[model samples]
Target chain A: GAGVSQSPSNKVTEKGKDVELRCDPISGHTALYWYRQSLGQGLEFLIYFQGNSAPDKSGLPSDRFSAERTGGSVSTLTIQRTQQEDSAVYLCASSRDMSSGANVLTFGAGSRLTVL
Target chain B: AQSVTQPDIHITVSEGASLELRCNYSYGATPYLFWYVQSPGQGLQLLLKYFSGDTLVQGIKGFEAEFKRSQSSFNLRKPSVHWSDAAEYFCAAWRSNTGKLIFGQGTTLQVKP
Candidate 1:
């Protein structure tokens, strides 16, 4: 894809139900990031992946949230036992490379998750 | 801990009026500053960034921001704002050690025609 792409533009899941959001990063990009934007709040970093290395998961809100990147191309964010507070816009972004200075991120349209 | 502060939660300006949005950051080391705009139902779009070089950095849409190290401020400005410029603006600062960004709550801009 020419730019970062995310699937399921919108999803509504009942509380306690599990959900999965997918992201397809730009081709040849080596760095991918996930963020969450709550209502009237700034974007919060969720995870970051640099190539095939272990991802930076420090920002995951809790153990219920996890993500995986396969083949260094597509990634999936999984939320187990979703809560109403989990509702937010999930954003995915990709950069050419992490080590490169002046790396501007290209972002996807984002997926709006609503936990009822 | 690194943090970004956008004092104004909402700002209103008439069309063709000059605009300034205040942003302050606290970081132990030199900061990587950025401003991004988000229209309703849209993802964030980077307006500009400041890493080094001249204090004043120019960005798209005739917007510019000046990095003031002394005051820990990076204020965004535009000579004249159009109706299309109405959007939510966010200021962010990245931690050099971890490359993580701490963003401000955001400022909603309203352009009156």
Candidate 2:
């Protein structure tokens, strides 16, 4: 694709259920990022993956939140036993290697998750 | 700890009016600073970024931001704002070692005719 892509543009799930959101980053981008944005709120960094190095899970809000990238191309963010507080628009973005200064990122439309 | 701050929660500017959106950051070492704008039902688009060199950076749609290292601020500005410019604006800073991009609460810009 010409731009970053995210699946399940809108997802509604029960409070206790589990859901998975997917992201397909632009070709050749080495840096991928996940962020959560609640209504009227700013983006909250969730995680970052760069190349084959260790992924940064420091921003995950809790143990139930996890993510993994496959083949350094696609990624998935999973939330288990989701809570109402977990409802937010999950955004995915990709950028060239950080070594490339400024680290400008291209963003996806985002997947909106709703917990009921 | 590093943090990005956008003090204004909401701002309103009439069409053709000049505008300036404030952004500030606190970090130990120099970091990458960025401005992103999110339109309703749309994703965030990068407005501009400052890593080093020139303090004044020009961005798309006639938007520009000046990085004031002394004040720890990178404020977005425009000579004249259009109605289409109304959107949610976010300021963020990325720390190289941690690869963490911290964002502010954001400011909602309302354009009135």
**Model 2 DockQ class:** high
Q: Top model by DockQ, which number?
A: 2
Writing each residue's lDDT as its tens digit, candidate 1 over A1-116 gives 98899999999999999999999999999888899999988889998888865447899999999998999989999999999999999999988876766667888999999999
**Residue A25 error, candidate 2, Å:** 0.3
- TM-score result, candidate 1: 0.96
Q: lDDT tens digits, residues B1-113, model 2?
A: 68889999999999999999999999987789999999989999988888889999999999999999899999999999999999999988887777777899999999999
Model 2 over residues A42-76: C-alpha lDDT tens digits? 88899989974536788899999999998989999
Q: Comparing only chain A of model 1 with the true chain A, what is the TM-score?
A: 0.97
B1-113 per-residue lDDT for model 1 (tens digits): 67789999999999999999999998887778899999988888999999899999999999999999999999999999999999999998875456566789899999999
